[model samples]
Target: MSTVKDVTFDLLRRLGLTTIVGNPGSTEEPFLKDFPKDFDYVMALQEASVVSLADGLSQGLRKPVIVNLHTGAGTGNAMCAILTAYLNKTPLIITAGQQTRDMLLIEPMLTNIDATSLPRPWVKWAYEPARAQDIPAAFMRAYATAVQQPAGPVYLSLPLDDWDQPMDATDVLRTVSTRVGPDPARVTEFGARINAAMAPVLVYGADMARGGADVWADGIALAERLGVPVWASPFCERPPFPETHPQFAGPLPPAIAPLSALLKGHDLIVVIGAPVFRYYPYVPGSYLPEGAELLQVTDDPDAASKAAIGDSLVSDAGLFLKALLPQVNARVAFAGGPLRKPPQTPTGELPLTPAAVYATLNALLPDDFVLTQESPSNIPQLQDQIRVRKPDVSYAFASGALGWTTPAAVGLALAERQSGRNRPVLCVMGDGSFQYSIQGVYTGVQQKAHLIYVVLQNEEYGILKEFAELENTPNVPGLDLPGLDIVSLGKAYGANTSKAETTEELAGAFKGALDHHGTSVIVVPITRALRGLLG
Candidate 1:
C-alpha cells in the first residue's frame, strides 16, 4: 500500500498541477518531506502574497494553479486574496494543513477555528477529509470543483500526520464530470433576437476568455455579422474581444447608472459570460436600458438560475457562440467611426497628472506587455488614456480590493517566464495600497522575475477620501499617510529603484526600468489632489 503522499503526488501530476505556490510552516513538514524533484515550489513570505501570486499565474497561464498554506492562522491571513480570487473567478486549488486527525476533539495548537468553514462564500467548495486515505480523492474533488463552470477557488484542509498514513493506489485520481452544452433552440432564439434588433450591443465578460480563443472567435464573428459594438465588462480580468478590432467599444462604465445612459440608444443588450452588470453602492439603476431587452449566455448554473431580468441560456459560452454563428447575417457594416477619445489633460508645469502618466506609459510600453493596475483613483483616466492593443495583456482587481497589483505582478512575470514569453510585466499601485503587500518584491527577487513596479505615491487613501466627501464628511481620520518612502522599501526588498519628480525623469526611469533584467521600482511623486480622479 502506498502512503497518502504518493497518492497525493500522483493526483497532482494527473491534474497537471506540477508547480505549487506556498508559504510553508511547521505543520506542513510531513507533506514537504521527500518532495518530488520534478515538482517546483514557489515560496512567498506570507499567505496573502502566495494567493495573489497564484491568482496572477492562473490568469496568465490560463490554467488552475495550486497553493499551499499552513493551518488556521495562515489560512486566515490569506482570506482577502482568496476573496479576490473568488471575485476574479480565477481557478485555484488551495490546500491548508490541519492539526493531526486525533487532535480534532482536543483542539491542538494551531488548530483552525472551524477549518472547513473558514473560506465560506468565497471558495466554490471547501472540505476536510475524514480519513487519511481519502486525501487524494479530496484533492480530485477540489480540482474538479475549481475548474468547473464559473471557475473559482476550492479549499482542502489536510492534517499533518495524514500524509504518512496508508492509502490505496487505485483510488487516487478520478474522472471529472462532463459539462453539457445549452439547448440548440435556445441559442437559435438568441441569435434571431440579435438579427432582428436594430442596434444590438454585445457585452463580453470574463467568460469569453474562460471559453477559450475559439469562443472569442465565434463571439467576434457573431458581433461583426450583426454590425454591433463589443464592450468589455467593467473590472474584467480577461479580454472579451480583440481590443485592436475596429468594432471594439472599450470597457463599459464602472458605474451602472452611467453605463445605462451609455447604452440607452441601443435596442438590445446581449450579455455573454458575465453578469448583467456589477455595481457599487449608491449606483441606482435598473438592470436593462429603458425598453431594451437583456439576453445572457453562461455555463454557471447559479448565474443562469439567478439572472432574474434576462433571458438566460444554460450553456457553455463557446458552444452558444458556435451554434449561434450561422443563424445571423454574414456581414453588416458599422456606421460610427472608432470610439471617441477622451480629452487629454493640459501639459502644464503642474505636478504630473495620472492621465499624463497613463498617456506616457501607453506611448512607451510594448504592445504585448502585461499590466496590473491598482491605482483606483486613476482607473477611469487610465481606461480612457491607455488602450490595450492585445489580448491577455491587461488586468485589474476585479474584486475591488487594494494591495492586489504588487504580488500579482510577480505572478504575471513568473507566467511569462514559464511560458517562454519575453514581454515585461508592469504594475501600477498607489502608495497606500503598495504598503499592504510590499513584501512581494522579495519573492520577485528570489525568482529573478522581470517586472517593473510603478508606485504612484499619492500619499493617501484616495477612494476613502472620495467616499468621505460623497458622504458629506470632508475631514476624515486614518485616510492620509505622509512621509513614507516607497523607493526605499523597494530597495530593501532587493529591487533596483528610482524616483521620478518630473515628467522627464518619469519617462526615462520607466524606459530604463523596463530594460532591466531583474525587478525594478519607479516611484512617482504625486499630489493628494490627484486622488479620486483616476478611476
Candidate 2:
C-alpha cells in the first residue's frame, strides 16, 4: 500500500489543487517534507496573510486552493481570514496538522484538543479522520463540499503520524459533481414578476462576478432588455455591473433608511447574489416600501433564510439570470427615477481632500490596471470619482477585515502574471489597514510583481469618527492616530516610496510610480474630515 502522503498528493493532483499557501510550523513539517517538485508552496509571514492570500488566488483563478496551517495557535490566527473567505463564498481547502495520534490522548504539547470543531461554522465541513486510512476520504469529501453550491472553506485535521500510514486507494479515486442549476418553476415565476412589473430594479453582488464574463454580459443584457435600473448591492466589494454604464444606479447605501428611500418608487425589486441588505449603524426602517414586492435569487440557503423581506430561490446566479432573460418582453426605455451621479467637488490646494485624490487617480487610471481597495472611510468618494467599466477589474474586502485587500492584491497580481495577463495591480488602503499585513509588501518585492500601493494617511480612525458623529456621541476615545510615517515603512519593505500632500504632488507621484516597473508605494497625507455616512 502507498503511504498516506503519496496518496494525498495523488488526490490533490486529481482535483487540480497544485498550489499550497501556508505559514508552516513543527506539526506541519512532516507533511511538507520533500514537497513534490510540481507543486508550488507560497509562504506568508503570518497565518492571517496566508489564508487571505489563498482567498484572493482562489477567487481570481475561479477554483479552490489548498491552505496548510500549523496546530491550534496557527488556526486561531487564521480564523479572521477564514471568516472573510466564508463571507465571500471563496473555496479554500484548509488543512491543519495535529500532534501524533499516539500522543493525542496524553495531551502532548501542541495537540489540538477537539481539533474537528476548531474551524467550525466558518467551514462547510470539518473533520479529523477516525483512522489513518480515512485521511484520503476526508480530503476528498472536503474538496467536494468546498466547491459545491454555496461554496466556502473546509477544514481537515491530520495527525503527524497519519501521513506515514498506509492509504486506501478507493477513497482517493472518488469524484463528485459541483455545479447546480436553478429550479425551472421558480425561475419561471421570477420571470413572470419581471414581465409584469411596470418598474423593476435589479440589485446584484459578487456571486454574479464569480460566474465569469459571459454571465456578466448576460446579466447586463437581461437588465437592459427589461429596462430596469441596476444597483450594486449595499456594502458589496464586487462589481456586478459596469459602473460607467448609463443605466447603472450607484451602490446601495449600507444604512437601512437611505436604502429604503432609494428603492421606494420601484414596484418590483429583484435582488440576486447578495443578501437582502447589509446595514451599518442601528437605523430602523421598513424592510420594503408599502406596495413593493421583493424576490431574491441566491445559492446559499442561509442567506435566503436570513433575509428580511424577500421570497428567495436557491440557485446559481449566472444560471438564474440566463434562464430569466428569454422570458421578458422587448426592451423598454428606462422610465423610472433619474439615476444618481457623483457630485463635482473643487480640488483645493496643498492638503487635498479625499475626493481630490480620487479625482487625480481617476484622471490618470490606466486601461489595463486592476484596483483592490480597503480604505473604508474614503471608499464612497473613491467609488464616485473612479468607475469600473468591466467585471473582474476591481476587488475589496466584503467581510470588512482590515488586512485583506493589500495581501490579496499581491496574490491577484501573481495570478494575473501567471495567466499571461499584463494588467498592473493597484492597491488603495488606509494607513490603519496598511499595518495589519505590511509584510506582504516584502513578498511583492521579492516576486518583482507589477503593483502600486496607495496609502491614504489621514492620521485618525476616520470611519469611527464618522460613526461617532452619526450616533451624536462626542469625545470618542482611541479615535486619533497621529504621526505614523507610512512612506518610510514602505521603503523599509524595499518598495520605491513617495509621499504627497498636494494635488500636483499626488499626480506626480502616481505618474512616476505607474511608469516604474516592479512594486511602488505612494502615500498621500490628507485632512481628516468626518462626513458621517454622506461620504
Candidate 3:
C-alpha cells in the first residue's frame, strides 16, 4: 500500500504539476515534510503574490499549475488573485491545508470555517475529501476539473494528518480529456452567416491567447481571409491579433455607450473566445449596436448565457475557428485599409507626460520582449503608443484587479527561463498598483528572473481620480499616494534601481536595463495627464 503523500506526489509528477508555488504555514508542513526531490517549490512572501505567480506561470506554460496555501488566513489573502484567475480562465489546482482531522468537534485555531465556501462561485469546484484515505483521489478529480473547457481554479482542503494515510491497491489513476468540439450544425450556421454578411466585424478576446499561439494565428488567418477589421475586446487581458496589422482596429472602450458607438456601423458582430462585452462605470446604453446582430463563439457556457444580447455557441475556441475558416469565403476587399496611428504628444522637457514616456519606450523596446501592464490611468496613452505586434506578447489582469502584474511578471520571467526562451519580460505598473505587490521584487532577486520593472509615478491613484472627475466631485481624500520611493523599495529587494525624470532618461534606462541581466527597476515620475478614452 502506498502512503497518501507518496500517491499524491506520484500523481502530481505524472500530471506535470510538480512545480508548486505557494506561501506555507504550520498546517501545510505535513504535506511538505519529506518533500519529493523531483518536485520544485516556489515560495512567495504573501499568499496573493503566491497565487499570482502560479497564475502567470500557468499561462506561460499553457498548462494547469499547482498552488499551496496556508489554512484560513492564507486562503483569504489569496482570494483576489484567485478571482483574477477565474476571470482569466486560467487553469489552477489550488490546495490548502486544514487543521488535523482529530479536532473536529472543537474548532482548532487556524481551522477554516466552512472552507469549501471560501472561494465560492469563483472556483469551478471545491471540496474537502470525506476521508483521509481519499485525499489522492480528490486531487486527481481537482486536476480534471481545472483543465476542462472554460477552465478555472479548483480548490482542495487537505487535513494536516491526511498525508499519512495508506492508499489501497485499487486506487489507480485516470486521464481526463480537456477539449470539446463544437456542434457541427451550429458551426455550419455561423459559417454561413460569415459567408453572407456584407460587413461583419470580428471581436477577438483573450481566450484565443489563453488557448495558445496556434489559435491566435488561426484567428489572424480568418480575419485576413474574411477581409474584415479586427477589434480586440474591451480591456482585453491578452493580445489576440497583432496590433501592427493593417486591418487591425484598436480595442473597444470598457463602457457600454462607447462600445455601442464603435460598433454602430457594422452589420454583424462576431465575438470569439471572449465575452460579448465587458463594461465599467455603469454607462447607460443599448446592449448592442442598433440593427446589428451579435453572435458569440466561446468555450464558456456561463459567459454565453450571461451575455445581454447575443446568440451563443459553446465550443473549443481553436477548433471553432479552424472549422469556420474554410467555410468563410472572402467576398470583401477592405482588408488593406491603413491601420490608425496615434499622434505623438510632444513633451520637450523633464517631467514628461505618460504619452511621451510610452512613445519613447515604444521606439526603444526590443522585438522579442514581452510586455505586462497595470497602469489604468495611462492605459489610453499606452494603447496609443506601445504597439504589440505578436500574440502572447502582452498580458494584464482580466479581472481588473490591482497588484497582479508585478508578481505575474516575475512568474513570466521564470517561465521564459524554464522554457529556454531568452526574451526579456517588461512589467509596467502605476505607482499605486506597484505598491500592492512590491514584495514580488524579492522573489525576482532570489530567482534572478530577467525582468524590467517600469514604475509610472503619477503620485496618486490616477484612475480613481479620473473617476471622481467624471463624477463631478471636486475633492476626494485618500486618492493621493505621494512620497512612495519606488527606487528605495526596489533596491531594498536587491534589484538594480534607478530614477528617470525625462523621456531621454527613460530611454537610456530601458536600453541599459534590457542589455543587463537579472531584475532591474526604473522609476519614471510622469506628469499627471489622463487622456480621453480610445475609440
lDDT winner: 3
Residues 36-123, candidate 3, lDDT per residue (tens digit)? 8888899899999999999888888888889999988899999999999999888999999999989955888999879999998889
lDDT of 1 at 361: 78
lDDT of 2 at 534: 47
In order, candidate lDDTs are 0.82, 0.85, 0.87
Which residues of candidate 3, in runs, are more than 4 Å off? 169-171, 342-345, 533-535
Instruction: Give the per-residue lDDT of model 1 (tens digit) for 1-535.
Output: 8898998898888878899999998888899888899899999899999999999988889889999999989999999999999978888999998888787888979997698899988999999888888888888888888877778899999889999898678655666643458798888888788778887888999878766667777877877777778888766766778776778887776666777887888888998888766655456676668889989887777777776577888777887777787788765577676664544763645477777777777878876788888877777677667666555777766788776778888999999998989789988888888988888999999899999988888788887887676556866789988999788888999999999877788889988988886899999876667444213
For candidate 1, the per-residue lDDT at 98 reads 88
Model 1, TM vs. native? 0.94
Model 2 regions more than 4 Å off: 168-171, 335-338, 342-346
Question: Which pairs of residues collide in candidate 1?
Answer: 377-534, 377-535, 378-534, 378-535, 379-534, 379-535, 380-534, 380-535
**How much is 52 displaced in model 1, in angstroms?**
0.9
Instruction: List TM-scores for all candidates, in order.
Output: 0.94, 0.96, 0.97
Q: How many residue pairs clash (N, CA or C atoms closer than 3 angstroms) in each of the candidate models, in the order given? A: 8, 0, 0
Candidates arranged by lDDT, highest first: 3, 2, 1
Error of 1 at 481 (Å): 1.8
Ranking of predictions according to TM-score: 3, 2, 1
